[model samples]
Target: MKALVLAGGSGTRLRPITHTSAKQLVPVANKPVLFFGLEAIAECGIQDVGIIVGETAAEIMAAVGDGSAHGLRVTYIQQEQPLGLAHAVLIARDFLGDDDFVMYLGDNFIVGGIGGQVADFTASRPAAQILLTHVPNPCDFGVAELDEAGRVIALEEKPAKPKSDFALVGVYLFSAAVHEAVRAVQPSWRGELEITDAIQWLIDQGQDVRSTVIDGYWKDTGNVTDMLEVNRSVLETVEPVVLGEVDTDSELVGRVSVGEGARISGSRIVGPVMIGDGTEVTGSYVGPSTSIGDDCVIRDSEIEFSIVLPHSSILGVRRIEASLIGRRVEVTPCLRVPATHRLVLGDHSKVQISS
Candidate 1:
């Protein structure tokens, strides 16, 4: 079996960050989310993989290369535009010829991996098998309506009034029969060919469209909020290992991983935190759920529940939390002027001054 990983999308939700970088390349626990998915796919023993890339194709190519690192031979399939999931499959027909394949969204983070699901699909050979999870807002996702018998009754893409809370997760398993289904479906009102529509086509043809509701952690790390949440989740399982130097003046508490050549001096670091290689933390309070990237410098500052990217520096800043700082950023104290309230008063305007 082969794998088709969809890494093409205009990540508008991530804004300035996405403007500079691909959303799938965003780090969770100092590692790219796309790498995690690729590793999972490799673990499932799928060696022939095809990655669908768009505008940020160069970056993805540079990072993944031959995919030998993940035990897979990757073939890059360029999709000029991210039309839709079904469109991706349409373009990858040659690469996925005749073989059953798994489609994984590049930015999705599914804890516990997809090995079990792959095993189950290989055993039964379902026409289409989808992973479903209960999300708070079903309207923002492709939702599934299941019958009392736990059979997939209908699928809707971003419905206004969702029939169920079960949103389709990014991982999907399909047999060779799905190619016919994709060919039979038409594009939705959104102009793009929706994958949900193709799956619905299978249902209409009496094909076995199966679904499994995953209870474990799953997140679509397309935006900042989910990215931070995934980061926090991945960090929870981190085993503390101190590979670098920690001065006598520095104190480490709880679970922390200090990478090679990283120096911590005159600082108090509380864990569930990871300090990357060659980083320096001095006279700072590094709190939980924070992953500081390699070669960063954190001096005389306090940060928690944040991700500081590689080569960034936070010096003499009072506090930072629940934030995402990009690479090569610098955060320092700004010169302060005398405290004063200056304002222009309009006619009949009443204002209260802080004295």
Candidate 2:
């Protein structure tokens, strides 16, 4: 079976960062989020893969190139616009012809890889199989309803009132039967061809639709908050290795990976932090769960649980936490006037002045 990875979203939720870069390319533990998904797909023994890309197609192409770097032959399928998940399948019909394929969202992070799920599908060859996880906010994701026998009965896309808490995870396994289902399903009210609708169509036709409820860690890193959280999660698995230069004044603690050419001096680095190649951290507190991208400069700043993109500089900032800094961005101390309160007194206002 081939693999179809969707890497084509505008990622409006990520704002300024997405404006400059593709959301899928955002790093988690100094590795592009999309790379993780590709690695997982590769581990499943799938060699031929198709990546769906949108407006940021050039950027994605530049990063992924021939896919040989990831041990796979990748075919780039341009989608013009991110109409929807099913829309991707519609356009990729030629590349995915006559073969069962796995559809994976590039920005989704699944703690345990999809090797098991792929193995199960390859063994049983289900008409359609979807990974599901119980989420508190079912309305934020495509949800599924299952029968008493634990079989999937229905699916909805971002329903106002969900029938179940099981939200569809980003990984999906589909047989050749889904090609017909995608053609038969109509666009939803949102004017996009949602994949959930295609799966629902199969269910209505009495086709085998399977759901695997996973309790493992899963996250859709479409927004900044989720991105930072995923970064923290991935860093937990880092193996401490210092391949760079560290001064006598600097101290490394816990599981920190300092890349080649990186230099840390007069600084204290907490564990589970990754400093990318050529990055320099001096006289700063690089706390746990932070991934500083390549060539970044962190001086006289204290950052923890944050992601600093490549070539960015954070200088003279006392504290920064839980932030997602974009590439080549410079953050410096504000050299402005002192703070002063300015307010207009109302008719019945009571005011007191500091001596």
Candidate 3:
């Protein structure tokens, strides 16, 4: 079996960050989210892989070339427009010919990997197998409704009134049968041929559609809020290792990973925190659940529960929390007289202020 990884989609939810970078390339624990999915597929012993890329194809290609680094020979399939998930499969028919394949969404993070799921699919050989997890807001995801026997009887894409809380996780297993299913389904009201519709078509035709309810951690890192949450979740498992220089004036507490060439001086770093390679943290308080990416500089600032990307700088800032800072960005102190209430004037295209 081969693997088809969907790395398309314009991540409008990630805003300015996505404007310059692909959402799948966003880092979790100083590593790109797409890397995790690729590694997982490689671990399953599948080397012939096809990656579906959209307008940002060049960026994705630059990041993942040849795929030999991950023990896979990757073939890039370009989608001129992201019509839908089913459309992705439609275009990859040649690459996925006759072989059962696993479709993985690049930006999704599923803890514990998909080794067990892949093994189960290989044994059972279902026409299509989808991973499901209970979500708070089912309307935001493709939802599945089960029968009395807990079989998936109906599926809907972002229903107004969801019949079940089971949201479709980003990983899916499909046999050659899916090609026929994709051909049978038409575009939904949204003008995109959703994969949910294709799976529903299989269900309607009495094909073997299976579901696996995942109990472990799973997240679709689509927006900033979810991205930060996933970052926090991954950092919780971080094992403390100090390979960098920590001056005597610096104090380290709890679980922290200090990468090589990182220097910590006159600072107090509390863990479940990661200081990436070649970074310098001086006279600052680095708190838990924070990932400072490689070659960054944090000076005279207190940061917690945040993700600071590579080559960024935070200087003389009093505090930053629950924030996502993009690469090469700079945050420095504002030079202004301190006052309890200072009248400020502004002009803007669109603004919403609460006072």
Candidate 4:
């Protein structure tokens, strides 16, 4: 069996960050989310892998060269545009010829990998198998409607009126029959050939479409909110390891992983925090669920439940939480005299005064 990983989507939801970097390359715990997916596939014993890439193909290729690091031989399949999931399969027909394959969305984070699903599909060789999780907002995802016998009867892509709360997780298992299903389906109203439609086509042909509801953690790290949450989740499992230097004046608590060359002085870092290599944290209160990237500097600040990218510096900021600071960013106190509520917002900079 082979694996097809989709890293081609233009992550508009991630805005300026995705504008500069691929969404799949965004770090969860000082590690790219795409790395985790690739590692999972390696664990499943799938060696022949094809990565579907688009505008950020060069970056993804550079990050994952031959895929030998993950014990897989990778083949890059370029998609000029990210038409849809079905379109990705359509283009990757040659790479995935006559074999069963697993399709994993690049940005999705499932806590307990897809090992079980892959094992099941390989054992039974079903026409299609998908992972689902109960989500409150089913309309935001491709939803699955199962019959009374727990069989997948129908599937819908971002339906206004969802059939069920079971939203499709990014992991999917498909046999060689999916190639035919992709060719038989038409583009949806959105002008893209939806994968949900292809799976529905398989269902209409009386194919065995299997579904599994995942109770463990799962998230699509497409936007900032989910990115931070997934970061927090990954941090929760980190062990306290200080490979760098921590001065006696500073105190480290809980499950903090200090990378090599990182220095902490006169700072109090709480648990579940990851400090990247070469970073310096001095006289700051680094709270839980925070991942500071490499070469960053944090001084006289307080940050919690946030992600600070590489080369960023936070100086003299009183407190920051639930934030995503991009790379090379500098956050300093606005030291203007009298502090007249100054803000530089979209295309305009203004200072508002109140009596």
Candidate 5:
């Protein structure tokens, strides 16, 4: 079986950042989010892979060239527009051929790899198998209804009235049987060929459709909140290693990975955290679940649960938490505002003030 990875969405929700960079290339723990999916596919020993790319194809190609880096021979399929997941598959019919394949969304983060799922798909060889997870907002996602035997009976693409809370995860396994389904289905109101609709078509044709309900962690890192959360989730598994410089005045706590050329002095670092190469943290507090990218500076400041992109600076900024700072950005203390009302704030406190 081969793998098809979709890396061609215009991430509107992550504007400004996605405006400049491809969403799939956004870093989680200093590595591109798309790389995780590629690595997972490699773990399944799928030697051949196809990546779907859109407007940001150049950037994605530059980063993942030839795919030998992941031990897979990759073919880049160009999608002229950000149509839909099914559209991506439709355009890659030549690359996919008659082989059973797994479709993975590049920007989605799954805590564990999809090795088991791929193995199961290859063994059972179902017409189609979808990964499902119970989500609170089922209406916001393509949902599935299961039968008494836990087989997928029906599917809906973001229904106003959901049949179940089983929202489809970004991973899907399909045999060549899906080619007919994709062609048989019509475009939705959104004017795109949704994969959910094609899968529903297969079900309507009495093909064996199955679902795997995973209780594991999964998130579509499409927006800032989800990106930061996924970063934190990946950081949790890092082995504590300091390949950089840590001065005697500073302290390291918990699981922290400091890359080469990074220097820490007169500061305290609390981990599950990642500090990229050539970064300098002095007289500051780098708190838990934070990722500071390469060549950044943190001086006389405090940061926690935030992702500071490469070449950014946090200087004299007393506090920053739960933020997604972009590359080459400079963050300094707000000198434009003067303290009129000063009060102590507990952690996670909320204050409403006019800007």
Candidate 6:
């Protein structure tokens, strides 16, 4: 079976960062989120892979060239516009051919990988197998309703009145039978061809539709809040390794991985923190669950539970927590008096206040 990875999405929720980079390329523990999915697919011994890319196709291609680096031969399939998940399958019909394939969302992060799920799919050979997880807000995701026997009987896309709390995870396993289902469905009210509709179509035709509720950690890293949460989750498992220089005055605590060329001086880094290659942390308190990406500079700033992307700088900022800083961005101290009560900020732009 081949693998079809969907790397195309506008990522409007990620805003300014997505404006500069693809959401799939966002780093988790200094590695692109897409890399995790590709690695998982490789582990399942699926070599022939097709990546569905949108406007940022060039960048995706450049990062994942021949896919030989990941032990897979990749074929790039361009989608002029992101019509829907089903639309992606519709366009990749040629690449997918007659082989069963796994459809993965590039921005989604599923801990423990999909090797087991792929193995089960290959064995059971269901028409379509979807991974489901209980979510707090089912309305934000495609939900599935189960019968008395716990079989998926109905599927709804972002339903106002969800019948079940199970939200569809981003990974999907589909046999060749899904081609007809994709063709049978029309666009939703959002004018996009949702994959949920395709699955519902298969159910309507009495095709075997299966659901596996994942017990492991899973997250759709589409927005900033979820992205930071995933970053923290991944960092929790980090094994401490110091490939870079740590000054005598500096103290490194649990599960910290300082990459080569990174220098830490006169600072204390708590456990579960990652300092990417060439990053410098001096006289700062780098707390837990923080990932400082490559070539970043953190000086006199106390950062915790944050994701600082590559080449960014945090200088003299007293504190930053639960924040997502984009690449090449700078956060500096503001020298002014502060008097704030309530500020109504608009959508999708940076806001700074003097303090």
In model 1, the worst 10-residue window by lDDT is 341-350
Instruction: Rate residue 225 of model 4 by lDDT.
Output: 89
Clashing pairs for model 6 are 254-271
Model 2, 91-193: lDDT tens per residue?
9999999999999999999998999999999999989999999999999999999989999989999999999999999999999999998899888999899
Task: For candidate 3, give the lDDT of residue 165.
Answer: 98
TM-score for each of the candidates = 0.94, 0.94, 0.94, 0.94, 0.94, 0.95
lDDT of 6: 0.89
The clash count of every prediction, one per candidate, is: 0, 0, 0, 0, 0, 1
lDDT for each residue of candidate 5 in 158-261, tens digit (9 for 90 to 100): 99999999999999999999999988888899899999999999998989888888889999898888988999999999999999999999999999999999
On residues 1-355, what C-alpha lDDT tens digit does candidate 6 reach at each position?
A: 9999999988898877788788899888889999999999999999999999999999899999999999999999999999999999999999999999999999999999999899999999989999999999999999999998989999999999999899999999999999999999999999999899999999989999998999999999998789889999999999999999999999998999999999999999997999999999999999999999999899987888888888878777666777788887766667763442122112233444343
lDDT of 4 by residue, 1-355 (tens): 9999999988888877777788899888899999999999998989999999999999999999999988999999999988999999999999999999999999999987889989988999989999999999999999999989999999999999998999999999999999999999998999999999999999999999999889999999998889999999999999999999999999999999999999999999998999999999999999999999999999987888888788888777766778777777777766442322221111111222221
Residue clash pairs of candidate 1:
none
Residue 350, model 6: Cα distance from true site in angstroms: 9.6
Quote the positional error of residue 333 for candidate 5 in Å.
1.6
Q: What ranges in model 3 sit over 4 Å off? A: 335-355
- Which regions in candidate 5 have their CA more than 4 angstroms from the true location? 336-355
List ranges where model 2 is wrong by over 4 Å.
Answer: 335-355
**lDDT of every model, 2 decimals:** 0.89, 0.89, 0.89, 0.89, 0.88, 0.89
Q: Worst lDDT window (10 residues) for model 2?
A: 341-350
**List of clashing residue pairs for candidate 4:** none
TM-score of 3: 0.94
Off by over 4 Å in 4: 336-355
Against the correct fold, how does model 1 do in TM-score? 0.94
Residue 196 lDDT (model 4): 98
Q: Which ten residues in a row have the lowest lDDT in candidate 3?
A: 342-351
